[model samples]
Target: MPRWTHYGSVEELMSNPLQHLCDISKKAQQHSITQNGMEEAMDYLHKLHIGDTLVTSTWKTLFAAYRAELAKLFNRIGVTLDITSNELPFGRQDLTTPIHSEILTHFLSTSEDRLDLSSSNLGTPRLHRTVASPKPLLVDLTSTLSNLKTYSRVIRIAPEKQQFTYAQHNHIVSKILSSRPTPTLLPKMETLLIAPVTDLTPLDGVLSLHTIFDQSKQHMLKFARDPNADEDTSKSETFDPVETADKLGVNAITFQILQSKRNKLLKFEWKRVMSDVRDPGVFVSYLYARLCGCVLFLSSSLSMI
Candidate 1:
């Protein structure tokens, strides 16, 4: 049951290398053989005629010609075949030989009139298999003013309230910065150290301090700005400070304090929370000693009392 496209001689095989391969593939199918098995059979046949110099020379020529035609066909279709592997070039390695044979048969049987040569059909031009790496996410302090301006447009506040908010924001930010041992170095620091409000007793008010911190942390992390993002894109990506402030039920100064601290805060990872230190309080104390050298205070009252 070997299906044969019987070429009279090596000359006929060299003349129609693709057709000969197709015929061999069909013959391989009858024996329930794979592409790899078919390749071995072809190599065995080649070795049988190796003693005859003319036949050997003709086979080398035929193989070279077959490879060239395959390359040309793939190039025309905008595919770069990995011809180094003995497997079919068009599809995945897991695909059966029969599927590969069908692909080849369909491609070869297609008429010129039926073939679509449009860019959409051919797909976009791609570089030689190079994948782009993702951009790093970093804070863009430069866009802070622009972000504030965007925040202003989304909320309706009186001129006096707006001015007071700005003053309050600045004052809290100044206190937070000034409290740091190296106050000048805080602005230059690339990343913020954020921790959960473990000691929530101090700020407990109408709303739980822990709840407010968690909400603010979630909001801050959700819209964390990319330093490299374009201006137009950043403009559209708004994190309304007013809305965040309202949610926390904080006044202008407290809202500013949270905003300033939140900006410097890094995304907290649970994996990193576990430490070798015997006491968690000791770790917190160490961080405080290293960063601020003093306890940062917060008041529940909106009006400074």
Candidate 2:
């Protein structure tokens, strides 16, 4: 008999949904699990707006990192997997209707644990027919996340170079970060949210509010640090929590307000910024003025087919 090593069986790969999802791309357990650019992912996700069905493909540079595993898993599952060498998931025929085919049904029927069910990717319904590919803004955002080094936050440093003024602060935060930032996906944005702790600063509810401020959900760490602050934030919570949260800063209430408001603001911001891209460059820094999720997303979710 010719010397031959047996190819692995599909028992685990085919039977389990979670396993199948993970195995969908076989290089690793979650090969296709996007190692999104934390900031970029946020931007792209915003552009997508919530409630939109993401049309991606296993044939782009971004997907190159996860392609093999996906192919293996699909092969194991007995689906005809046709994708490009790069492995991105966008602008392909697979995204078309049939909404009922085997693979199509599998994807449509599967309830994504990580998928934000907040309506559209940007959190609202978009009127477009299909998402286009090679959306540079989305790609750039992904690249930014893939290159993350450390968590970047905006804190009030002790009167650096220029004198402090709201215009300057706005200019500094907005102008400086207009271009997409690069690095690993930032899972915890709270870690990057900080302000200078000065002697004059009162250790009131604002002291450690971002962590605890929960209009809907309680953030234990923040509450433990300062239990007294919650009283004021509860009243401010509303449909437009971002503005309320921003004005209040990152207190327990503000943080909670943020948690509730983030999806909404991201959606609004995404729509406002992506509607035309008349300026073209505006998309890169759409979230320069955003509250959070401004820089964190998969490095590749663009396609125009």
Model number with the top TM-score: 1
* Per-model lDDT: 0.30, 0.25
Per-candidate TM-score against the hidden true structure: 0.18, 0.18
Q: How close is candidate 1 to the true structure, as a TM-score?
A: 0.18
**Residue range 144-229, candidate 2, lDDT tens digits:** 43233422322221111112333323332232122212212111112222232111121322222222222212222333234334
Per-residue lDDT value at 140 in model 1: 18
**Cα shift from native, residue 165, model 1 (Å):** 83
- List runs of model 2 lying over 4 Å from the truth: 1-51, 61-240, 243-305
Estimate, for each residue in 1-305, the C-alpha lDDT of model 1 and write its tens digit: 12232423343333223444545545555667764565554554343221111111122233333333333222332333332223221222222234333433433343431223322223222221222641111111111212222211111112222222334434433433343343333442112212122222322122223333444444334434442243333344443332222222222224433333223222222122223232223222222111110011122111221
